[model samples]
Target: MGYSRLNVVIRADASVHIGMGHRVRSEVLAEAFSEQGAEVCFVVHASCADFSKEGDFVFGSESEWHELAHQADILVLDHYGYDAAAINALFQLNPNLLVLDDNNNRGDFNCRWLLNPLSLRYSETVQFPLTGGQCAQLRPQFSKYRAVNPIGQQKLLLTFGGTDPLELTLPFIKSLFVKGFPTEFLLIMVGSGVQNAKEIQDYCRQHHMECQIGVNQVSELMAQSRFAISAAGGTLFELACMGVPTHFIQVADNQKDALAEHSALGWCSATDFTGCLPKQRVSLIDKVVESVLKTWQTDLTQRSQLARECVDGLGAWRVVETVLASRLVK
Candidate 1:
């Protein structure tokens, strides 16, 4: 059967602590589901910003999900806070469940499908049947772009995802300036919900750098940049898509494993910001600056090729097809 008014409820959350990757990815899924004639709604926390126009957002307690669970033809989860028990409850309410996870750090989850591109074949290592059975590898939608030619681009982009809760922007700029990070290449910093925006803007102005707040055309920016210093989160996929060689720094726990794997695979260079308090990051500026300059000097031909090859923009379509096929099977 076709997706005629099929109800898809996406459960996720966004905040300074949780960051925005989950919500952003969920919005992408919502778009794909909506195109297939599904009614998509978001069940998020009250603190979450209203970022998507494609769906309605609802706020309530965990018990409230039962109501949504009852109405949903399928429930998609992206939030890390949801445990197995909670997911099991939702699964009992509605058997059609799909989980989008990165680390697989959580315990057992009784869901019909689990989408994790990183560990698709490493399911045995993570103790989950995430490879051969009901699991599907879902990459970001940016993998569809052609390799970016870096000849004319004279900018170094900096993005730390949505919140930058660790406040790495200003320190990174100062480190670059201290290391004299090529004044010929302009610096372009972008972010949202940044508490230190004024300080960052002032620093950029004083240093002749360009700062863009709340930018919507991030893909365009990434494609145009010659280099980037970014967080090792979902944005890494976008950077990889454009073949923009990046130096990644982790600001969340979920990103640690992926950072290690990606860096080991030569996709990007990484640094961990976990455990180290925000105040202590200032001392690590030299290390960050050294890594960025080193990576910039190295030839990126092979690294760019590997990065672009990892993701294809067709993941959303794949997910939609798989979900629909599973429904038909039922």
Candidate 2:
């Protein structure tokens, strides 16, 4: 059952437009595959090349994908840009194709296995298993940090993915200030993709607040925060693993359903800002501030407990096992 001979190639991309959630989660799964003795490589777009490791391939053409598909024993794809045609082309090269999906809105996939951590619906076309937050691929630091009590200072950790494509960081902070929220209670973590990092840093400095850009030790920051306001993406699962009561904002169309599901489960508070104008967003911020305060006052402890119970921080291993099991059966 050793995976030493297996060659797993993960294909994903990150940029200011799409954010880095895809690449981040793919790395978590890649780490699990590597730990199981499998050789792993990432094939990413050029825009994301700067964030990739030394041996990672920066793909530019279809021929490059064909070459990777031919070489890979199992091709793990976690990109949203690829349609069915692109996937089918890869499946033709290697039958052992595993796709990491969130919304399952790509019509149909030609892969051997399809995994959606947000849902557990049966699929007739491909094998779908371990479909829940229990399969969320978070880094090892989250689980290690989870062992520590997360009820630290009353500070709020704020992040909006790697890009914050919507530019929610400064606006959110300004709204908090406008609402008379304690300036000392904010710990802003700006993403590398954010174009206004300099401005955010300056604003935080002027207000005597803390701000960090492109931090690798996010778990440490989460451990220091009793609550959080984050975008509804992979970070939600990570915060859940850390047991930080969070209020998540929907910044994308695909996040709508997941937000509703998590909210219904009492894991976190949810808000939708997908199509709001600048003025409307400012108004919505008032509602978000109210919700954050209400949740902090009413059910912070319960939400934290529910979130921790939802994701145990071992999902990457479970996914690796599933892939290994498939190889064994084959």
Candidate 3:
């Protein structure tokens, strides 16, 4: 079977509200598919007319989607907006459909394969395949980042998703200052499309903290970090693979499941700020930061081991291989 003849279409979105995890994940998958000689096209959704045009924008109606679905060899859905019924419609058009999801609540899946990298543990109650499907237990992208940096050169990393809609970056920096931000560990903050980018940069400059915007080298930074403060999302898996200890906050409601379960599994130090008020958040931030600072290394060895064991960083390859093999059999 020639993979070069295969065509894969990935449908996902990136916006302030939905976050950029889906878009980034789709890109990763696209690169993997392309590496295997598959023709991949990413059809990102535009939320509304008011939504700013970014990336490769494709406009089409439902009929157009059906048309494309008919021509595509495989259709990959990684959006929360797509329910099982909606997915079923696309499945009928193309039986070779892949659904990438974090939440196991998407009811029944009618796709050829289901990949849920978010949920590391395999259980009987899980919605997707436990052993047969591509779960991406160990992400392949983190291979370069797996090597731990010298402890003395490590910094404290800060990242709040791609958009940082909650504007948690600056406030978290201020909280650190309130607790007398340690000069020993350099602060590194990263974000794209953040509303408060200028303010954060100014604050960072004034306070001598490093602020990076629209960066593509996060895995590199994660490798050089002693610890990271990040939103509980896809980055969790990356951090785990890099063996970087993190303090996580569930900035979005959809992140609750992954964050809670990963934290329970001792992946990172975490707290839920879904509905936290200003005063309460300030207090909680201070407490969480201080607690992490004190015992950050208590389980560092074990956490890093679990992370390396769970996230091998070859998820993309596994996905490409599985999907292609399934195609040949059909």
Best by TM-score: 2
User: Between the candidate structures 1 and 2, which one is better when assessed by TM-score?
Assistant: 2
How would you encode candidate 2's per-residue C-alpha lDDT over 156-215 as one tens digit per residue? 888988888888899889878877778788899888778889999999999988999989
Clashing residue pairs in candidate 3, if any? 138-311, 138-312, 138-313, 139-313, 139-314, 140-313, 140-314, 140-315
Query: How big is the positional error of residue 83 in model 3, measured in Å on the Cα after superposition?
Result: 1.2
Candidate 1, residues 1-330, lDDT tens digits: the string is: 458768898888877777778877777777778778888888876556454343456565677567886778888888777887877777777778878888777777677777775643433222223322112222342443344455644577888878888888888888888888865575555577677888889888888887888786676667667778888777776776677778888877888867776677777887888899767888876788887787787777788777766665566767777787664213
Q: What TM-score does prediction 1 earn? A: 0.88
**197: Cα error in model 2, Å:** 0.8
lDDT of 2: 0.83
Model 3 lDDT tens row, 228-326: 888888888888778777788888777777776667767577878889987687788787778766765464667666555657677877877777766
Model 3: CA > 4 A from native: 48-57, 119-134, 137-141, 148-153, 297-299, 328-330
Query: How does each model score on lDDT?
Result: 0.71, 0.83, 0.71
Please give the range of 10 consecutive residues that has the lowest summed lDDT in model 2. Answer: 120-129
True lDDT of residue 185, candidate 3: 67
